[model samples]
Target: MTRMIDIIVPVYGGYEESLRCLQSVVSNPQQTPYRLLIINDASPDPRIHEDLRQFAARHDHVELLENKENLGFVATVNRGMAFSEDNDVVLLNSDTEVANDWLDRLVAAAGRDERIGTLTPFSNNATICSFPRFCQSSAMPDQWDVASLDALFSRVNVGEVVDLPTGVGFCQYIRRVCLRETGLFDVERFGRGYGEENDFCRRAARLGWRNVLCCDVFVFHEGGVSFSHEQAERIAQSQEVLQQLHPDYHALVEKHIQQDPARLQRTRVLLEMLRTSPRKKVLHLTHHLGGGTKKHIRELSVWLTGGMDALVIRPVEGGGAMLSFGATDSAPGLFFSLPQMYPQLLELLRAAGVSRLHFHHTLGLETCLWGLPHDLQLPFDVTLHDYYFINAHPSQTDTKGRYTPDLDAQSSSYPLTVSLEEWQDNQRQLLQKAQRVIAPSAWAVREFQRYYPGLNYLVAWHPDSEKQMPWPAVENPYRGERPLRVLVLGALSPEKGADILESVAVAAHKESAPLEFHLLGYAYRPLADAVIEHGAYSEADLPRHLQELQPDLVWFTAQWPETYSYTLSEMLLAGLPIVAPDIGAFPERVRHRPLTWIEPWDSSPEQWLRWFREIRDFLAQQNRHARPWQDQPVPRGAEGFYRDSYLSEMESAGEKELPAVDDAWLGSLLLQSRQAEGRQGRLSRKERLLMHLLMLRQGRVGRLVSRLVPVNVQRKLKRKLSRKPIHELHRK
Candidate 1:
């Protein structure tokens, strides 16, 4: 016969906590035949009664019992136990949140030994089961998601059961036979609760019933949910009653706790095993845990964790550290000033047993590690997301709408600020210390080589595609006699081709061309009414929006070169025909794909319109010719690419011992960086002095100086001053 278990929860107040407990039980279905019984012990709040009634009506397996008079927790639980006469009983507190397989693990543990009468699981706030200590309540790490923690616990303490003097009352799983032998809780002796479970456990121990703690399972307990206001009085009364009933009860309990010297040591070992068993520990450093970089880090971390232990450390706003376990689990954050908190951060890393480090974007938090690569003793890799190191403006676009390939060219257009130059020099120095420099695309790799040159680097495509394809088939949005639907995705900023879109839409409307433009992202400025704005959409909602507003073709109209186009990769997965500029990674991404047309980077408004019409007509002809959408295999997903690339790089890096940090050399480099920052951008000292003197001169003298010098001469002189070779300056 299948064993049955009845879970009884006694509730007095805290409606929200009670509701969460019920929801967790219902959501996490267990394999064993079980029923949930919630006993309301005359709660003063009418809302609690109504909520319980509603919950009972909604769930057929749930039974709600309301006491007519105020019966304390001990009596309420004893009354609830009568319903479980023929089944095992689990006295679960209303404030506890259970995870999946929690019941199965407990039942399995109980079945391990026939003499085992009661079983308890580890919890964040239970008395003996509380982590890091046997009695004190400590908060669980913030990065602990239920699933991950459950898995970690199972892996760490499988088959490791410990004998406990008493079971924690918050979540006690008692066999029906043991309940029958020991009888219900001693309600007369400990009427209002606090020590009733312990009193009963001591009684059961006299009858040769052993209480065990199943270390493999973890349950979250939000302690002190019921009768919290009367805790001190209840505890004092219960203690006096317990001492009278059993003369040596307190001394025996203390003796049992103090005698177990291995318990704390075993607990620490279990925690360490859960943290670092069967995997290399990797700590990823990034700025913020949001946006594209956030998504990238999350994906990589999750994938890497399958074979390794991965954690992400990012700065919280207002200063502190937050550690994320994989994509879902995050520990509670701590605040500390960057740079000053570097030693503390290092200590945290050491405690976590981090073996390797991966650095992503560190824009706002770079000050924390001004020369981290030189100081850190672990093997590390840096992934370049943009051209921040080579150019002041990360987009590598100058003020005149031109691409600047070299630092000298960039300096001629946009000079660096004091702080910015220091940051760039630091970036260069960090790159020199990296085990490998990873780029998302070959275009990015080429750009990095062109600028930095000769440092080890490799192209590892980001896992940019969504794991599951939200849409099954590409729906043809084209219809006879209506304008062709053209779709553009991304923020409508100037750099993202908002101006180009406006010009194209206006031209299409004026020319009466067979086209209609639909913008599907946030717009800074108002567009013509002819251009339909779909507004901003979250990652989850974007696919649904695309399916709802199916367009004939997707367009990529960025004013500057894209390092890697996440949208373009998504559109390809959707099997939609794309029109993109022949610049940056766009060309390489859509190289051999069918129904893709690439226009020149310098394509004018008229040229863009002409290409759009031609592409639209070409797609129409292809449809007429009966071309299959799935004529070619979809490109390989990026996760596999990244996994292979990363593993290969790690192997190639080998076990070369990193050289010790040369503080003197590092100090010189930092000094040069500070000196560079102090130097005025572009202009020499003489030019700045001359300009100051010219400003002080009267109108005639100033005008004469301005005419004689001219703006062109000043620009030429500034460029000459800024053109000092980077290597020469660094050497000096």
Candidate 2:
């Protein structure tokens, strides 16, 4: 008779996610008898032991093992497996989510052939929510079976068994014979992380045991688990050991990681219903995984409109993207577009099919960039966009609430550029956390060097201007002979200069410049009285409108330091020379072309008309020189503005040393250390978090939040002056 299935969870920190993991595991609807084995690896934070004690007291099937010393990965996995009395021992990563029948499936698969020593499961996507929620991210894909099927959905066979390559990562179902013969996990040889699985699998295979993949068993795994920097270093050191153990496996591991031919993003909608946001979720997860955070500067990426995807990269990976948003106390009228449609964007990025992500931005990022723990786990470099140093007492103003576009002053206390003590307090964590930093501009490079001294950073420039030009140059589709119809595109808000455009339209009508102007965009008012009120036209409507109105010039006027104008880029691509405010990155992106800049002094309609007329006449004279900005010789380096200039130099790059720990209400530590750590050693990430709470260090801000808000609240609430998160966007 098959005695029992012994399960092991060796963790350091990760308390909450761990709790959820256990709840899922113990409640795993399997008829086969099972027992849970939890090893505490002398975790610095102790609450892990306390939670285990509480859990063990309640569950008869659970057993607890404590390591008095902080036994690294090698000893931990082996120690956990040793505590198992069952014939079949399942080595499971604490961060993994297992399906209900995951156990039976793996056991059956591994038990199929006497030579089958171990069984593995094909993986599923995992997510990390954006900052702040880095403390508590509940986002994940659904593992439940489909109650109904859709024609567009990928046919999932659910429980059908399948084979695996060499190793069974995360979920490894090992046989008793293999363990007895080869010993559990090449303890000394494999050490921890990466190649250990392959090493073990190879060994099992060599021992005449077959390693099968139980494709039917779906498992969810986070990138890394909660741990301190020291533990992480120790984990990295294991890589050398892995290469030494089996030199041949080195190529295989490198091939698997680097040769990820298809762009598999962290976020992708698993089912037809939702998408994940990788950036946001990955940020949140950095805390859970043995990783950290970094400061980031915002860039007015012209041409690539942020829309909503920038807000969340997880939905595109794990679940489907979000669509509509409800009005919130913070940002009213802030429409959340395309979150649910992120799969399309992810598909494009993947289609780029580059092995690693290579992108750039001009400015430095904010102090509180990616909200995650400081133990940065990823071993790769991503362009940081920027880094800065703080000097004197600084005041910042950006992102200060502009949900209504024209309502507030055109700047925010956007901290992405500061290197002040306060900024460092927010950024040091990410700085200490990111694997490598890439600064696109020399200014950004200086800032990064000033703050994160000796850190591995590259002062790289964005690929030359030509690469940035949009594709498929089209002739003026709106061929006009009569009224030289003009199009004013963008949100019909105050800063968008909609009112100004209204005056321009009236002025044009009065002058009878043989021109008719139609405002095209999403209607924002109670009702759109004109052709378009929101003033923002969809891509599909653009061609139709062009064919119908045959507009001559597309004017994009934003009375703000708006960078990289997407509208301008589109106009340039459409062979339509545009009239846009020459500020921020706009001048840099669409340069050496006939355009009009809105000067502050020229507020009168006549003055605007004169300039508009000159612009139109220039367009008429240019003989369809409407090719992309590629052929246009825009003077380089002329486009320069500190994205964080609003922030005093004192605050641009961190000034003072790293900030003192947040004194705000570290009233208690969650686990109180005693129960937090186990006999074997440290607790998991969840345990450490609980321990911090128990120690009164953080997590209970009673008066801070009074209500539960949905994810959709951000966009709708940004316009509410009273709502701080969104209220920063106050109307002028």
Q: Of the candidates shown, which would achieve the greatest TM-score relative to the real structure?
A: 1
Off by more than 4 A, model 1? 1-6, 9-217, 220-274, 316-322, 328-332, 368-374, 400-415, 419-424, 464-480, 624-641, 648-732
Deviation of model 2 at 715, angstroms: 39
Compare the candidates by lDDT and give the number of the best one. 1
Q: Model 1, 63-141: lDDT tens per residue?
A: 9998999899989999999975698999999988888888888888888898999998888787766654457676654
**TM-score between candidate 2 and the true structure:** 0.38
> TM-scores of the models, in the given order?
0.57, 0.38
**Which parts of model 2 are misplaced by more than 4 Å?**
84-86, 125-155, 158-165, 190-194, 228-236, 253-597, 600-732
- Locate the minimum summed-lDDT window of 10 residues in model 2: 283-292
